[model samples]
Target: MNKLWIVLTYAVFTVLLIIPLVKMTTAAFSGGLGALGDALSRPEALHAFMMTALVVVTVTLLNTLLGMMTAVYLVRGNWMSRWLRRLMNSLVDLPYAVSPVIGGLMIVLLLGPGSAAGAFFDHIGFKIVYAFPGMVIATLFVTFPLMVREVMPVLQEIGTQQEEAASTLGAYSWTTFWKVTWPSIRWAVIYGVVLTIARALGEFGAVLVVSGNIINRTQTATTLIYQDVENFNVTSANGAALVLAAFSIGLMLLMEWAKKRRGVH
Candidate 1:
């Protein structure tokens, strides 16, 4: 009896989520393989998917490194890194509180080519806030806190004493990290990276503002899907959306592998 109620609750929630997914897939395959093939082969769709993949890769690298450094500083630094810790931690909450569009707008306010600092960049042939650079920056701003948040708590749980012990034993910085610190935090780092990749690939609002929605150029997969839907090309939109969904699923699988690796170690 109790098991039945629990099953019912989950079944209801599962249906809620699966229904939309079913609709999306239905839209994708309603016209069969021919439509799917056409959507996949479209140059614009291919370009958007490739651009999204590149952004995911870039964001993962940059955020993982910076977030690791930030995590280490928060845990081990001596000179009132506490204040900086507070600041960094506070920014972690921005993704939840601030809208992505607002984040993109903030970037434009500082980096738009029309601004003075932006003029200097323009003079140097570095365009921002309406190009690829701007799109990446916007994605970074929105995805910035994910890696830190994922890893910091794990770092805190591991404590700094292991690092201290390694230092006392004359282990070099890199060696100490690989030997002592990384073992415990590595899974968290991997999870963070996967999450950031997902976020960067799916990031729409922030990129929309900064990318100028430039099709076949600055159009990311998410934005391309948006344009397709808006233009009443539901089939194309679903096809592009499925590509993003596949990307998201791939990262999630990577995260599962990382989790297993963590368990093994």
Candidate 2:
């Protein structure tokens, strides 16, 4: 029975993951390495990748800082009322519950050009909707939960005893965080950052809706792939997908390495 289960698992994995990866690889290379290079070297493709890198870096940094703060507050803020903490905790998971498309639409509704906030920002010469800022915001919405979720459990598990001890020993709050709290949650923060990067890289719906997929301005790698497919440029789409897949695979390996390091520690 165990042998049968093992075979079944492999079969399922191959069918769902391996086969598709193989197919994509084949398709991406169908026109040879020169074609793949050409596809990726196009002006639009270069811009799309650069936009994606910007979003990923910005979102990851913001999410890591804010998410860790939020998790610490939720877990350790004695000043917060019980109900308030509960409310905040529930809100952290809102992105996971809500569809990304809906999240994008909400951004559009709240801050698009027609809305008051959007108009205000636009009048101030800072466009939010259908621009780079909007893309970052949308990606942030989709990826925020990842870091919070990763850090919260670690904070809970490590408890506040050490932090309290540090404070009692005359350490300032910032000192306590750096000396007593940071080391404990560092791995969790790293994990959250990796997850945020991965999600931001592949995010399509929200970014598309918010960025308007403007070429050379707000286009991301995923949206570029969508545009390519829509234009029946299958080769270009395949090449772009392969690049994303390569990044994802590298992240996966890094994640595994981190997991092993955490385990050893």
Return the top candidate by TM-score. 2
lDDT of 2 by residue, 1-265 (tens): 9999999999999999999898989999999999999999999999999999999999999999999999989988889999999999999899999999999999999999899999999999999999988998999999988999999999999898898899899999999999899999999899999999999999999999999998999899999999999999988999999999999999999999999988998
User: After TM-score superposition, what is the CA distance of residue 178 in candidate 2 from its true location, in Å?
Assistant: 0.5
Worst 10 residues of 1 by lDDT: 73-82
Candidate 1 lDDT (Cα, whole model)? 0.84
Cα lDDT tens digits for candidate 1, 37-133: 8987899999888888888888778888887887777667767566886886786778768999998888888888768988899999988878878
- TM-score for every candidate vs. truth? 0.92, 0.98
Task: For candidate 2, report its TM-score.
Answer: 0.98
